[model samples]
Target: MDFDRKQLTNEQLLDLYKKLLKPRLIEEKMLILIRQGKVSKWFSGIGQEAISVGVTAVLHKDEYILPMHRNLAVFTGRDIPLYRLFSQWQGKANGFTKGRDRSFHFGTQEFKIIGMISHLGPQLGVADGIALAHKLRNEGKVTAVFTGEGATSEGDFHEALNIAAVWELPVMFIIENNGYGLSTPTNEQYRCENIADKGIGYGIESHIIDGNNILEVYTKLDALATSMRENPRPVLLEFKTFRMRGHEEASGTKYVPQELMDMWAVKDPVTNYREYLKTEKVLTDEYDEALRAELKKEIDEHYQQASAEPAIEANLSEELNDVYKTYVFEEVNSKSNSENVRMIDAISQGLKQSMERHDKLVIMGQDIAEYGGAFKITDGFVAQFGKDRVRNTPICESAIVSAGMGLSINGYKSVIEMQFADFVSTGFNPIVNYLAKVHYRWQENADVVVRMPCGAGVQAGPFHSQTNEAWFTKTPGLKVVYPAFPYDAKGLLATAINDPNPVMFFEHKALYRSMYQDVPTDYYTLPFGKASLIKEGDDVTIISFGAGVHWALETLAKKPEINADLLDLRTLQPLDMEAIFTSVKKTGKAIILQEDTLFGGIASDIAAMIMENCFEHLDAPVKRVGSLESAIPFTKALEDQYLPKARFETALAELIAY
Candidate 1:
């Protein structure tokens, strides 16, 4: 599309100028706030406001925006009130996050803008999910996700772009080439001439434009946005500009050369745009003066009013609230037995039943379609639910989790599966940083379940076998469930999918086909944060979860004289503290067992909780039994030695003797 001044009327041009000017002026005032010690930091969007404003102009009022910290003009162009922006910066009680987060890292559903994370690249994949949902719903909406040239080097950039391209999602991936990423120059980062060139490999249309040229930015983005809405294709756009100030008000920026700064100073976007408006006779001198006065007075008044508003007081209870959504499922007739089933079969049945109950529920993972997910857990799902709902995603962990959250944001329940537990490290950023924090940040429903095949008894080596539930147990706003028996696995999994929160569901790979139990055929949901007592006794209490529960139960069975009370914790995050306390108070001695490494494992946490609550009832110190700190080996001999039944039995006997 060629830039033609005749395309837009003078009034439209003047309106675009105001959108560009508001953020520039607001940032100037923000810099003053930093200097006055009111704000701790400021990421100035001084020279790049034109690009964000132009992109936002092309988007509809309800279109979603995934913006970074430097794109303040997006809020202005999206019609978020200036006073709210000021209130957010001032840390007032009326801020978007209730003053929980500072700076540009807060978003509200009303504005359709996602709060930015400092990592800068994870949200692009999330944007892909939102676009995917819009396409599925036949909604004529597009998502614009902003990032920097430096962030494009991150792995998340490729994962997001590749999936978006392969799915033909309606997303506009815009990169702001501001010469430097924090302090590193673009030349030092990548040898490519343009970041948009990378988009060609994914079969996406790429565009390069001068970000300082407001007309070019607006015209190019407007054309792409219009075309993508109908055609449903991802677009990558790179806009060249420069950062006029330090990375933040507190950053020294000594590495930036004075000569380069001087060169960019001569081409300031705000000054250039004003000059162009005047040259086109779009703004008379008197009109310009009055516009400037009006903007200055409004901004000053907003800042003063926002600053005077009461600061949010520290509230421990409120901070802990809204972490998890409370869900209620009706109870059916209680039954201890119905028909024998394997763990794998029970899981597949549970998933099938849940999907049948909820029409909007979706399941996505690698090779989960006809391939049945590496483990054949979803063998007949595609035939039943169709390929649209049982999506087979690319080999990208971050994209899998992020896209699931995106779908959840658009009112769909997603069950995302990580192929193996050890592979979760690749997708940890989105899981820990974004999905786990989504509910707390804006009280949004992150109604997604991430299933991980875990445990080490399979001899699949370090790459496949792992028990990493302890990592998620420490993270707030996530529910971690690991069931030991087939009945528990089926019942708990049904609850996990129905409940409205992000759940990290760990399924022990070794227990899938090896364990068999009579599970109820009827639909049911087990209560979260409650434990199941496998055996009742009074000499000692054994607490375990997942595969370790079987190990401990067997150990106790062999030693009949111990008279142990065995407890199986179904959920790790919402732990059954009451169950632990009751059993500990009865038996007086306790043992905690797990399949993860001994140090920093769930066993340590259970031991700590027992001591904290049952100090007076204890007859001996709490004992923890788990695998050694070394990684799981490949050979059967070494793997057996690493996680041996003898280790657990020995620990159990020691606690009994003491």
Candidate 2:
């Protein structure tokens, strides 16, 4: 379809010219600064300004855009103050990320922009989440995400596209085929005719356009965005473009053939748009020169102002703050009414109660809706809450986790379940890189709870049985919760769901059905960082969590002579060191138990802390007991031997005798 030039007024045409020109001028200024050592690095979008400018210009302000490093025009087109962006690049406190991240690696909620991480494709999943929010609220808003052709090879790209297509989400998957992925050419990347063709495989409407032509890009994108708002669905647009410079300033373009450079040089988006406007009498040569001069002056002034701002100071307390939003527990009277229930039922009750309390709570995972998940934890959720809130997802761990993050971005709380604990390794990048770092990087709350059904006991073998709590406990900006009893499972799950930071809630598969207790019927929450004192004595302190707590209980019951102070640590990230110290001080001996291997488990960390804090009070050395360092075997006998039950019993007796 041809672009109707008559559709735009003369003033709007002039404004588009300015939008295309400003980023080009800014890139030139940034290059100068890089040469002068004022700026460290830059991803040049020098020749590809039209794609960013035209696409952003066509979108509404309330709509969200996730832009990569090269799309500087997206920021400029969104009317973000030049000084603030400059401040961010200069590592000033006033920048969007407050100097936590560099360059375009940060996002600003104020501008409805979600910035890219070093891993390019995760943001596509995040875009799906934002689109999911839009679809849920019936907001008629579309989410636009930008990526280079090289990133399309990532699994997240396929996952995000398939999810959007399956759900018919309002998302625009925009790809800039810039001829190279760092030094590798397009032919080496994929065999498909174009990136948009891959979208067709996913049943999405795909289009290809001349990226150098500003009019074509603007008109095509505007029509697509309008249609999407009326009928919510995903579309892919591939803009065939060229990289005018190296990937970054340090990487020289010695690999590009001179002929290709010469060919693309004349087709520059900014320069050709300027010539077209002047020839059409929309902009005079005199006005064009004045506009260029004005843009240069503004860039220089903003750089100066940003450079003059204060740099970040090194303060430990201040730096440690804002990892999580402060959650104040409401004081509720303890109801006398209670009923005996299994751990699985208690967790289900907690989720049902939380869903009743918060209208924005959403639950998603594989076979979770009608099938009620692999373990039947969400058995009746679909019937009670409907399929919209309790969603069934494809076997895409990475995308679903990121979508949950996106939902949290729009004030919705999400509970995403991993079918098995061992499967979390597939989605580790987004969890560790994006969800765990977003708040610290840009102060955006990732209100997501990932339910991990973990631990080894049911002969499910290595693939199904694994204790992965230690994986997330070491990561900052994340909460790790592991419950032992039915009561603690329900209360802590509720607390984890309510917290404003990302949480990894580990449910031991072995304890899900075996453990039972009288759980409170009414809504309640257990605070994190507080350990439940199950039994108190002076012989020794048995510190453990999850299934390890059960083993410790069995050991104590079998040996009636040995008295011990048993503590179940409810949360690992916010560890209850105070309780451990108090118990160790009274007992003067301690033993840490865990289901993970003994080589590098959380038990070692707890033992180290106990020794460091309560060394003088100890009679015997702090004992550490964990599973054998090998993959869990499927046989019942081998599985029992692989676990830490026998080790915990031996360690407890040895510590008491010592």
Overall lDDT per candidate, in order of appearance: 0.86, 0.90
**Model 2: per-residue lDDT, tens digit, 479-535?**
999999999888888888888889999999989999999999988888889998999
What tens digits encode model 1's per-residue C-alpha lDDT throughout 465-565? 88899889989989999999988888889889988889999999999999999888767778789999989999998888988888887777788788888
Enumerate residue pairs that collide in model 1: none
RMSD of each: 1.8, 1.3
Model 2 residue 237 distance off true place after TM-score fit, in angstroms: 0.9
| TM-scores of the models, in the order given | 0.97, 0.99
Model 2 bad stretches (over 4 Å): 1-6, 331-333
lDDT of 2 at 96: 84
